[model samples]
Target: MYVQSENPVEITEAILKMDIRPKDLIVLLVAESDNLNLQALIDRLNEAGVSFIGGIFPGVIHNSTLHKVGVVVKKLQSVSAPVIIQGLNTSDYRWPDFTPTLSGLEKKVTAWIMIDGLMPNIASFLSGLYDRLGDRVNFIGGGAGSLTLEQKPCLLTPNGLLQDAAVIALLDYDTHLGVKHGWKRLAGPIVATRTSHNIIYELNWEEAFTVYKNYVEKDCDCKMSPANFFEISKCYPFGISKSNAEEVVRDPISVNSDGGLVCVGEVPENTVLNIMKGIPENLIAAAAEAVEETLNQSAHNDYVRHTMVVDCVSRALFLEDRHEEELEQISRRIKAVRPEVSPQGMLSLGEISSYGEGYLEFFNKTIVIGSLY
Candidate 1:
C-alpha cells in the first residue's frame, strides 16, 4: 500500500494500524521530495517494535502513477529479517554469510537487495554478493537515493537511516525476472582508458568529459556546461557492451572537477561503451517487453501474487510527461496475465537483477520487472 501523508506521526500510525503478521517484514519506499523527518518516523517504528527495511528513492510507483511525494509500504511475508551491511563506499569489505539463515527454509529463496545508490563500489559489492550466494538464490532489487545526487542518511533500518550501507533480505516467493532498456546505440565503441570505481577519468586516452561532450554537442547541436549536464545527458547515456545482449547502460549524472564523468554505477577500465538514445515510444514498448519476458519465462505462471517494478528515475526524467505511458504499458501487460496484481515499486537510481539467469548486474536507465508467484 502507498501512503500520501508526509507527517511522520501519521505515517507511523498507518503502519502500526496495518493488519501485519508477527513475522511479516515491512518495506518503506519513501519519496525524496516528501522532506519528512525520517529519524522521527524511524523512532516511532522502533518504539512500536516494528521491523522494516527500505530507503528514500527519487520517486515511488503505485499502480501506474509515479508519485514524487509519498511512501510505498510493502508487507513481505515468508521473508527473513533484513541483514544490514555497511562500508559500501569503501573497497575492502566482507559480505555476510547467509547459509545459516537459509538452512531451515524448505522452499526456494529470492533476495531483495537495496543499496546506497551513490556509493562508489556498488558493482564490487554486488559482485561479491553474487560470488557468495551464486544462482542458488534469485536476486532482484535496485539502488536507492535522492535525485539531488547527495549522499546522506537515505537508507532506513532498525537502527536508523544510514548512508554507504545496504539492506538485504531473503524471500521465499518464486520470482520471474525481466530486464530491458530500450536505448539504441547512437555512437561507437569508445574505450574507457582510465576509471576508478564510478568515475571515468579518460576515454580513448583522453578526458572522459571532453570525449562525451564532443559527441553529444555535435549530435544535439548544442553546447554542454556543468549547469546543463544533467538536463542534456539524460537523453544520452553510456552503454557498456555485453556479448549477445542489450548494452548495460551507465547514467552520467555529473561532471567532476578533473574533467571526469561520474556515473551512477561503475565503469571498469578498458571497457567498451556506446552512446545510447531512446524515443518515448520505444522506451514505453520496452516496458511492455519486460513484462512479456517475465510472463513468458515460466509456462505454468497462471497466478501472480504481486508485481514489482524497479524502473530508472532517469528514464522518467527523459520521457517527462510521457513517462505515464511507460508505466501504463507495464500495467496493461501485467493485467492481461493476472488482473488482480498491480505494478508497485520505486523509480530507482540504479536497477538490479540477474540477467537471464546469467549474472547479477547494476544498471542505469533500465527497467527490471519481477513477478512474484
Candidate 2:
C-alpha cells in the first residue's frame, strides 16, 4: 500500500488491525528522514507479531517530490515467504566479501538494499555484491536519503542507523519472479574509445571535453562552468546497455573543469557507451515501458504488488522543482496501467543493475526505464 503519513507507528497499527494475517512478513519502508524513535518503532514491530525488515529513508513522500520519505507494506500470501531478506548494516560487508551474504539466500532472488549516500565505495560494493547473487538474482537500490539531520548522523538500521555502513536485504517469493529490468544505450551509443575508472579519458579520440562540449552546445547554448555542466545535461542522466557487457556508469557524461566529461562510476578503456536523456516525457514513457517489459517476463500477475523504485538522485536533482512532478507522473502512469506499481518510492543516490543475464534486476525493473529491456 502507498502510505504518505508521517506517523508510521500509527500506520503500522492500522495495518495490523486489518486482519493482516499474523504470519505476514511485514516490510515497512519508512522513506522519511524524521528521527524515528528507533526504539519506539522497534517496540511496535515486536508487538505486531510479524517479521519485518525495513529502514528510515531520507526523503519523505507526502504529496510529491522524490526526495521524501514514506512507508510501503507488503504481506506474504501463503507461507512465511522468505523471498526478501535484509541483513545487518555492519562491517562484515567489505568489498568482494559481500558475495557470501547471499550464500544461502540466493534462492530468495531479488535484493532491495538501502544505504547512506556517504557510504564509502558503495557503487563498487554493490557491483561486488551483484557478482555473487549468481545470474538469476538482480541487485538494485543504492543509498536511501534522510533528513540533513540524519545525514549528519546517518539514520540507524534495525541493528543501528548511522553513517559509515550499509544494509543488504533480500526478497524471496514465487510471485516476485514477475518483475524485470533492462538498459540500452541512448544518446551516443558513443563507444568510449579511451577511459579510466569512472573517468572518461577521451570520447571518439577527441578530448572528452571537446566531444561533450560540442554535444551540449548542439542541445543548449550556455556559458559553461563547473556548476553549469550539471545544469546542462540535467546531471548527466545516462542510457542503459543490454548485453550487460559494459562496466561503470555507461551513459553519464559529466563535465570537468578543463571542459572534459566525467562519467559517474567508471568506463573501461574502449568500452562502447551511450549518452542518454530521459526528458520528463521520455521518463513517463520509460516508466510505462518498464512495466510493459516486466509483463513480458511474468504474466497473470494477481495484483500490482508494491514497487520499490531505486531511482538515481541525480535524476531527482535533474528534475529539480519538478522532481515531485516526475514522481507523480511515474506513479500516475504506472497506476494508470498496472495500478500496483505503488505510488510510493524512494529517490536513491545511485543505482546498480545487471549487465548480462545472470541476476534479475529488481529496482531497475518496476520504477526504472529502458535500462532493462
Candidate 3:
C-alpha cells in the first residue's frame, strides 16, 4: 500500500492500522523529495515493534503514476531479519557471514536487495553477494539514492538510516524477473582503455569525453558542453556487450574535471562499449515486453500475485511527459494476466536483477519487473 502523506506519525499510524503483525516484514520505499526525518519515522516504526527495511529513492511508483513525495509500504515474508552490510565505499570491507541467515531459508528463495546507488564498489559488492549466495536464490531490487548524485544517508534498517551500506532481505517468496532496456546501438565497440571503478578516462585509447562528444555531436549536429552533458547524455548511454541478451546500459551522468566520464554503475577496464540511443516508442514497447516476459516465466496458477517494477529515473527523464505511456503499457500487460494486481515499485537510480537464470548485475537506463507469487 502507498501512503500519500509524508508525515512520520501519520505513516506509522497507517502501518499500524494495516494490522501488520510482529512477524511481518515491511518495505518502506520513500521518495527523496519528501525530505523525510528518517530517524523519527524509524523511531515510530520501532515503537510499533515491526521488522522493516527500506531506502529513499528518486521517486516511488503506485499504480501507473510516480509519486515524488510519498511512501510505499509493502509487507514481505522473510525467513530471517534483514542483513546489513556496511563499507560499500571501501574496497576491503569484509562481507559478513550470512550463513546463519541463509541456513534457515529454503534452497531457492527470493532475495530483495537495496543498495547505495552512488557507491563506487556496487558491482564488486554484488559480485561478492552472488558468490556467497550462489544460485540458491534469485535476486531482485535496485540502487537507492537521490538523483542529485550525492551520497548520503539513504538505506533504512532497524538500526538507523545508513550511508555507503546495503540491506539484503531473504524473502520467503519466489519471483520471476524480466529485464530489458530498449536502447539501440548508435556507435560501438569502443574499448574502455583507461577506467577506474565508475569513471572512464579513455575510450579506444582517446580521451573519454572527447570520443563521446564527437559521436554525440556528429549524430545530433550540436555542440556538447559539461553544462549540457547530462541533458544530452541521457539520450545516449554506453552499453556493455553481453552474449545473447541485450547489452547492459551504463548511464554517463557527468564529465569530471579530468575529462573522464562518470557513470551511474561501474565500467571495468577494457570493457567493450556501444553508444546507445532510445526512442520513446521503443522504450515503451520494451516495458510491455518486460511484463510479457515476467508473465511467461511465471508458473503459478494462483489468481492473486504481486508485481514490482524497477525502472531507471533517467529513462523517465528522457521520456518526459510520455513516461506515463511506458507505465501504461506495463499496467495494461500486467492487467491482462492478473487484473487485480497493480504495478508498484520505484524510479531507481539503477536497476538490479539476476537476469533470466543468469548472473546478478547492476544496470542503468533499464527496466526490471519482478512478479512475486
**Which candidate tops TM-score?**
3
Predict model 2's lDDT versus the native.
Answer: 0.49
Give lDDT tens digits, candidate 1, residues 1-373: 8999878899989988888787778889999999788898988888988888889999999888999999999877655678899877766665777787767767667788899999988998899888877877778899998888998888999888888999998876878999999999999899999999999999999999999999999889999988899999999999999989999999999999999999999999999999998788888888889999999999757867878999999999999999999998999888887888878999999999988866889999999999888
- CA lDDT, candidate 2, residue 176: 29
Estimate the TM-score for candidate 1.
Answer: 0.96
Pick by TM-score: 1 or 3, better one: 3
lDDT of 2 at 191: 62
What C-alpha lDDT, on a 0 to 100 scale, does residue 32 get in candidate 1?
92
User: Which pairs in model 1 have colliding backbones?
Assistant: none
List model 3 lDDT by residue over 128-190, tens digit each.
Answer: 899998788889999999988888989988899999999998887778888999999999889
Looking at model 3, the pairs that clash are: none
Candidate 1 worst ten-residue window by lDDT:
88-97
Clashes of each: 0, 45, 0
How many backbone clashes can be found in candidate 2? 45
